[model samples]
Target: MLAGSAIVFGGVFGFVAFKNHMIKQFFATMPKPVVAVTIAKAGLTEWRAVVPAVGTLQAVNGVDISGAMSGLVKSIAFESGQDVRKGHVLVQLDTDVEMGDLRSAQAELALARTSYDRSATLLRSNTVSVAALEKAEAELKVRQAKVAGLQAQIAKKTIAAPFDGRLGVRKVDLGQYVQPGQMVANLQDLSLMLCDFSVSQKDLGLLGIGQAVRMTTDAWPGVVFEGTVAAIEPLVDAKTGMVSVQARFPNADGNLRPGMFARIEIERPSGAPVVTVPASAVAYNLHGDAVFVVREDAGPDGKTVSKAERAVVQLGERKDGMVVIRSGISPGDVVVTSGQVKLEHGSLVSVAASDPLKTAAAGAVR
Candidate 1:
C-alpha cells in the first residue's frame, strides 16, 4: 500500500510541472502590448512672460464741479449724465438780485460822473476851492469801483462748463438753494482712461514707461483692452513693498469709466529659446524638474521596445501654457507628457499619445 501511494504522488507532481512549463511558453510567444507615440518636430517657438495685477480705472481728466456763489438755482441746463462742451452753460443761479445790484451801481456811477464833470469845470474856472473839486473826484472813483465789483458778481451767477466732459448725477435741481463751494456735479473726460496698479519691488526692473499691457474689466466682459505704461511712481510704497504703475488706454467710445476694477497683464522680455516640454511631463523632485524621454532601441526579437531615459532640465519663465526650458533637452526630442508617475531612470516605457497639445491651446485662449 505504501509503494502504490508513492507512485501516485510522483505522477501528480510531474503533471503540475508540465502545466507550469506550458503556461510560461504561451506567455513568451504572445506579442507585447501596443502603445501610441507622438513624433516630435522642430518649430518656431515664441517666449513671453506676463505679470498679473488688480487695478482701478480712472479718467485721464476728471473734476468735481462746485458752486462759486451762494444763490437759488434758477435752471439746470444740463441733464444728469449729459455730455457738455467747454463754455457751455451748466447752471444758472437766480441772477435777479445780482442784476438789481448792478443797476444801482450803474446809476450811482452816472451821478458821480456828472458831479466830476462839474467839479473839473469849476476847477478850470477857479470858481470853487481845490479841496471841493478833489472831494468830488474821490466820490466818482469810489462809484466806478462799485460798478466793476457788481459786474464781476453777476458773471459768477452763471456757471459754465470748465471743460468738455460727461457730467455725473446732479447734486442740485432747479430752484434748489446751493451754498458757496457746494458740490454741483462731477465731470469726467472719458476720451482716455488710466489704470492704476502696483507690482512687487522685485519686478520693478522689468517694468518701464511705454511697455504694452493687456487689460480686462468686469464691467465689460470678454473684451481685452490694450494700453501702454504711462508712468511709474518715483518711489515704492514702504509698507507694502510695492511700486505703483499707471497705464493709459484710448476710450474714444466712452466705454471705460472711472473707478472700474480691472485686471492688468504686463509683458516682459524673455531670453533665448531653450528646449522645452509640456509642464505635465516634468516630475518634481528635491533636485529639480525632470522628464522621461523615450529612447528607441532594438529588442531580442529585432523589434523596437520604447525605453525611458531620465533627463534633468533647468526651467525659466512660464508664459501662456508653456514652460521655458533652459537646458537638458533639445528640439525634435520626444518626452513623456503623462503616465510617468512611477517611472525611474533608464526604465522601460510605452509611448501613449494624448490630446495634450489641444488642451494647452484651449487654456491659452481662456
Candidate 2:
C-alpha cells in the first residue's frame, strides 16, 4: 500500500512539472500583438452632470366633471370635444321646481319685510311690544335665508367649466338623468402641461425647483419641449429608490398632450473638475471598466515605439458619448479611444499624425 501511494505522488508531481515548463515555453514563443488605434489625452473638464430618467406627461389642471346634484339633465350647453372658457355652462339639470321655490321665497321675503317695518315703527311709537318687533325681524331673516337657499339649489343644477380647457366627449346626454358624483365629462386645461418624472434618490441633491429641463417625446420625434421644474416630491419611492419631480411647459401651440411618454434632460450647474474620455475608450466586461493607455518603449532597433498598456479605470457618469474617469489615469495620458479589439497589455500601437491625441472637451464633464 505504501509503494502504491508513492507511485501516485510521483506521477502527479511529474505532470505538474511538465505543465509548468510547457506554459513557460509557450509564453516565451508567443508573438506580440500590433494594433492601430485612435488616441485621446485626458484633460480637466467642468460641466453639468446630467442623469437620465423616463417620465410621463400630465395635465396641470385636469379633472372629471361630475354632477354634485342628482337630476334630469335639461340640456348640455357645450359640445363635446370643444374649447370652453371658465364659467361656461357645460350641463344643466332640470330646475323648474327650484325656480318656483325661489320665486315663492322672494314673495315671502317681501311680505316679511313689510311686516317687520310695521312692527318696528309701532314699537318705536310705543304701540306694539318690543317682543313683537323682534319676532317680525326674525321672520324676515328666515325668509331671506329661504330665498338664498333656493337660489343656491338652482345654481347647483347648472354645471359650468371651472377653468379654460378643452372638453372631452360628452358622457351625459340632454334630458338624461344623472346621479350625484356621476361623471359628465372630462375637462383638461391643456394650455400648460405638467410632466412628472422620477430620478434616483442619490441624484436628488443635483435637482431643485425651478431648474430648467429639456424634454422629448416619442409622439413628436426630434422635437424638444422646454420647461422648469415645478415641484420635487418630498419622499423617495421606497420600491424604486427614486424621487418624483414635476415640470411645467407651455402648450400654446397645442403640440403636447397629456399621457404621452417622455424623456427628460436636466442640465445642472457646473460641478467639480473631472477627467473624461470618449465612450469608445472604455472597455467594459464582467471584470470591470478598463482602457488602453499608450506608452513609449525602446524597440529592438533602439527606436521609440508606442505600446498599449491595459489600465483598469474607475468611472462616473456618462454623457453625450463621453465618460468621466474617477481614477486610474491622469491628464495628458494618451488613451486608446478606438480600435482596441486586438489590443492587450504590452501590445504595440501605431498612432499617425492624422490620429494625433485628442484633448478632452473643456467643460465637457462635471
| Top-scoring candidate (lDDT) | 2
Please state the error at residue 105 of candidate 2 in Å.
2.6
Error of 2 at 58 (Å): 3.6
Each prediction's total of clashing residue pairs, residues at least 3 apart in sequence or on different chains, is 0, 0
| Alpha-carbon runs more than 4 Å astray in model 2 | 1-44, 51-57, 124-127, 196-209, 231-246, 260-266, 295-306, 332-334, 337-339, 348-366
Q: What lDDT does each candidate get?
A: 0.80, 0.86
State the displacement of the C-alpha of residue 40, model 1, in Å, after optimal TM-score superposition.
Answer: 7.1
Count backbone overlaps in model 1.
Answer: 0
lDDT of 2 by residue, 36-155 (tens): 787877767774776677888878799999978999998888888999999999889999988988989999999999999999889878999999999999999999999998888899
By TM-score, the best candidate is 2
Candidate 2: lDDT over CA atoms? 0.86
TM-score of each: 0.73, 0.75
Candidate 1, 283-340: lDDT as tens digits: 7889887777778888877988787778888876665545666787766666776667
**Number of backbone clashes in candidate 2:** 0
